[model samples]
Target: MTASRPDIRTFLCRSDNIGVLLRDPATGACAAIDVPEAGPVLAALDETGWTLTDILVTHRHADHIDGIVEVKRRTGAKVTAPAKAGSAIPAVDVAVSEGDMVRVGSLTAVVWETPGHCADHVTYWFEGPRLIFAGDTLFTLGCGRVMEAEPAVLWRSLARFEGLPDETEVYSGHDYVLSNARFARAAEPDNARLVARMEEAERAKAEGRFLVPTTLGEERATNPFVRAAEPSLARSVDLAPGTEPERVFTALRAWKNKF
Candidate 1:
């Protein structure tokens, strides 16, 4: 007898780092979000007894895609990467662009080209589950470093996410929860919500649990980079109420780059 289609199981591939695994339980077929290391990914698969079927890459950063070849060798999974990032990822079977729909078994994950952390950075959003593989583009409490692009580009990309329903779940590619909480404190010390969340993050780490899949609403409220354009935050950056949103974005990003 044959198993049903799709039915993917999502798990946190966590170590000192983090990634996400999307497994189609029916067929034991799986896909991994940005892989930080081959070891953790392999372990995740071993635990589930699944075969890696595809790699949904978001960017070209080695930390995000370095395990590609190894994972592919172990499972013979096809690879899909951003059109602009295909060259960096070995053996890409499909080069997708923004607005493209990537099918993983019976599930459809939409591609979002979000550049700032890298010119070729992209993200994937699984529709039925409302889960986002945010790569370095978005994190629980913090965002990725503005390494290869301007702060403004990132700001716009983040704004696009703001329009998503508040209940949307976010799964980022790294485990910087505690560190990001610290910066959130500096950005809004008086925000009791931020402080409370920081304590929760500490607890999750101490208990060996993942503190991710934070809601779009929670990030909108406490994420400094996304809220950097607010008048209060702009004032802290020495900007007037009338300052251009992009300028505010720049100041907040500069602060984080050094913070």
Candidate 2:
């Protein structure tokens, strides 16, 4: 039997980080993707009247796990973190690795180790609902800065998402659509889809709305980082037309670092 769609609440935490609450309606099992701050997570729980049953940590980054202790203290939620991060993250009840399945009520998410920005980074893919909590691995039109690994490693991590259905909804860790849109346009100036996406991002920012939960199709169409294999992106980075995709990606990432 098909599972019922889960209820999702997306809110701002700290400055630009995103906080999400995923609740299984049938069983009311709620999970917070990451706790950037306890106050916002608590507030969202209060407003929605949903009890947090699990805290799913994406990586060991402080911005993502800073509030884990407090939120766990208050709600007694089970904390699940990357096995690779081990004790670096606080209050972890479960240490999961690649291919592990995490269940919240009837909802199931397969853990995918998508390291690039950091070695311990993981993305939770809820296949049943076609939703991905991409952490810092991917944003709307951009990807996380390569902090712990080579640019090629990040490219490989991003390649994992290309085969997903176009309608899959991606929930990333931060709100960087406007800046990513700007950089994407510079990388692919003549792309009408990118231009349209940039305009939408601008309007979203103006209205104080977030351009998150972006569909995979939208990312494929407009995200330059993911489209590094295209000859145009190679040319934007001053690489030859037939350059290797990985090299093209590296150059694009280098350019984006300064952009």
TM-score of 1: 0.91
Prediction-by-prediction clash tally:
0, 0
Clashing residue pairs, candidate 2?
A: none
Worst 10 residues of 1 by lDDT: 2-11
Please provide, for model 2 over 146-193, each residue's C-alpha lDDT reduced to its tens digit, 9 standing for 90 to 100.
Answer: 999899899999999988999999999999999989999999999999
> Whole-model lDDT, candidate 1?
0.80
Q: Scored by CA lDDT, what does every candidate get?
A: 0.80, 0.94
How many angstroms is residue 85 displaced in model 2 relative to the true structure, after the best TM-score fit?
0.5
